[model samples]
Target: MSHITETLNQRGNRYGEFNRHAEITQNIKKAMQDSPNWATLKPWHREGLEMIAHKIGRILNGDPNYDDSWHDIAGYAQLVEQIVRPPAPPVPPAVPMQNPMRGAL
Candidate 1:
């Protein structure tokens, strides 16, 4: 499995309960909807990570206005993972090369 998939799975296993928590889920959705333009404004990959880190720090620091829960953090991390390690492209089948001099040999 890929690193991103592994990380996501591990997080899911660890915090699966929050996935079903109505308040947490709603908070995550609200946070995302409130910041719709952040992704477009900060197009750089690193900028995205920094933004997530900033919000996480706010939560850790007990910022009352920043109501993002662990679920929100995980969602942001998953987004970053998707951006950093996108799915691999499908491999094309190999074609047999004809040897012009094979019969001539």
Candidate 2:
């Protein structure tokens, strides 16, 4: 088979695996929505959780060893944290920038 054809076939298979158990993903998200705190979450929080849930579901249905899904989960959670959590206070510079020549004769 041609290289392009082989690549396309591999992609198609991955898509197949992802969609083969579509209900599983939806069920996971549905259960999450049932949580009492779900309503209280900010929109971004809900989105992040849902995305994480999706990656989780995919991992469950597909390769358990897949590293990308884990990274994706962390990325989504980080994005949610950025939006929902308060920003950390800025740290003071250890040494403030100054003109060396300012005090020089």
* TM-score to native of every candidate shown: 0.33, 0.70
Candidate 1 deviant stretches above 4 angstroms: 1-43, 63-67, 89-105
Query: What would the per-residue lDDT of candidate 1 be over residues 1-105, giving only the tens digit for each residue?
Result: 999989977655544533354344456545764685645544545455555654554453344344455667667778877877868999999999999889794
The residue-level lDDT of candidate 1 at 23 comes to 48
RMSD of 2: 5.1
Every candidate's CA RMSD: 13.1, 5.1
Candidate achieving the largest lDDT: 2
Write the residue-wise lDDT of candidate 2 on 2-89 in tens digits: 9998886775454345465477789999999999999998889888988988887777776667788789999998888778788899
> How well does candidate 1 score on lDDT at residue 40?
58
Which portions of model 2 show Cα errors greater than 4 Å?
1-19, 91-105
Q: Where does candidate 2 have its weakest 10-residue lDDT segment?
A: 12-21
